[model samples]
Target: DVAMPDAPARPTTPELLPPNRMPKRGRGGSERGRIAMLHALAHVEYSAIDLAFDVAGRFGALFPRSFIDDWLSVGADEAMHFAILDRRLTAMGSGYGALPAHAGLWEAAGATAHDAAARLAVVPMVLEARGLDVTPETVARFEAAGDLPSARILQRIYTDEIRHVGFGAKWFGYLCANEAIPPAPRWQSLVRTHFRGKLKPPFNDSARARAGLTRDFYEPLAAE
Candidate 1:
């Protein structure tokens, strides 16, 4: 038999996610920007569900066992979210691919893929947390417009998402404490450095405050 040398192992970098989960941009780039944004958001939420499951399964000891349960719930919720958006789009005679969506959310996920702390920072804490802040306006708009069904659904999503961002805050704090990163300031700095978008003002303080945001986190943000 011919001798064969061992194959070199592949490196997993944040710049590129695992091959199967790589995010492709341009799924929703077009005139129907709102629908495209909806499509993109649903897909990213779906992807977060996958990340949650992996963490729950592979690192059970590191994370509370229930983390898996939480992620699974989020997964189910994401499916519903996708379905809702899909149905609405279809009602308008358009669908998920009808427009173009840049892969901003998943690109950030990829950026922090190599480190769990980074992942937690970029995904749940920054991205999903933003959802909590922004969702109330969406919900209120639905209510004002007499879109009761949308309002109801948005209410549920907003509530559950608060807990999800709370998970990020909890985990982020825990990781910082363990790593001796001086939890508070470090968290503020990391979120600021990695997150580029200015958090739009007239923000949903009540919803965000409910979602485990500390005064430290919001005060500076309010100042901005």
Candidate 2:
């Protein structure tokens, strides 16, 4: 087991994000706004890495140790995601620190900050799962834009994001089992209660299944 002297005593409120700047409709974006959102996402992933590291360092004695490593790896992969997206956005004549990005992801991070179980549920299962579904569409957009390089980047993001969300599935199942709740039902219940956004059509079936979800888990979810 391991521990850290400097792990945060509690969750910290993020200070640097600008505001909710995601486009409401399909609209053209400037380089600056894209860059700003990338920077904001980077800040989040970087903080996730730190949180994972700290959890491993300070609380290894209390729970499973491997999750910490996984979370750290998740952070690294998200950092790569941020870097690639940011670079592509920059190459398009934009840079980070220009537009605003909602703190929704980070807010989820904070909401689950105090509980590893909640973190696993909200961050990867809910958020990164959305990324999984979007990756292919993003690639298509890139290819349509004549940006093969960006499409390739999105392909990599899709692959990595699947694994990241799988981590959530694995650990969330474990937690539910620990509390004597069946995994599938528990997950369905959570999604119904917490999520408010409209889940789009054209789900990534192969990717979702690869991320440890079965037809039983997804069919009902997709129907909702």
Candidate 3:
């Protein structure tokens, strides 16, 4: 059985904002900027703990027992990641909720709540996969600034996110196969229907490929 309740609401602190109103995550040149960025990453990880559990609880009944196993593991990893980030923030004399976070992440979850396929497409495939593309540079920035501890934390999250994305792609493929739908085109259609933004490029194709989300799954859908 899944371990969490259905669609638990996020916390009230950190003063959630719409995506447009959130401040820019400035380059990690100053301690203030670095703390803000860590706070942002912490918020994402905290929200992800909910996302992993929500997906498992809300959709687990429709799939095999392994589905719950995989997602529950993902949730555990997200929780660990959040704890690490929050501790890192405290070590920096800051912590989670010290900065504002956007509510767009959970909004996407809510939009795809009823469809497992759509949920997989939007959250892990699109959003978590996007993390693969960007996190390397974030780690590098921290490293270049002589912030090895923070860089190491982000590097670990980057590695784990690859597997999280793999779980999404694997389950999505299973459902598509059972339904006699093709993977790539169906993914495109789902993104068009459920995702609010365009699929952009310069994607981390190698990392995506490692996660079973190849160019074939997303390249055609890239905004031209």
TM-scores for every candidate against the unseen true structure: 0.71, 0.75, 0.95
Stretches off by above 4 angstroms in model 1 are: 1-41, 54-61, 221-224
Higher-TM-score candidate of 1 and 2? 2
RMSD of each: 8.0, 4.6, 1.8
lDDT of 1 by residue, 1-224 (tens): 33221221222311323434644533233325444445555555555655565444444456665666766666676677767766766765676654444356656755555566666766776778778777777666556655566457667777778887777777777778788886657766766767666655665667666766666675675477
Roughly what TM-score does model 1 have, to 2 decimal places? 0.71
Rank ordering of all candidates by lDDT, starting from the highest: 3, 2, 1
Whose lDDT is higher: candidate 1's or candidate 2's? 2
Q: lDDT value for candidate 1? A: 0.61
Off by over 4 Å in 2: 1-21, 24-62, 221-224
The sequence of per-residue lDDT tens digits that candidate 3 reaches over residues 1-224 is: 54544456666679988899999889897778888999988888888989998888888888999999999999999999999999999999998887899877888998998899999999999999999999998898899998999999999999999999999999999999999999999999999999999888779999999999999888888954
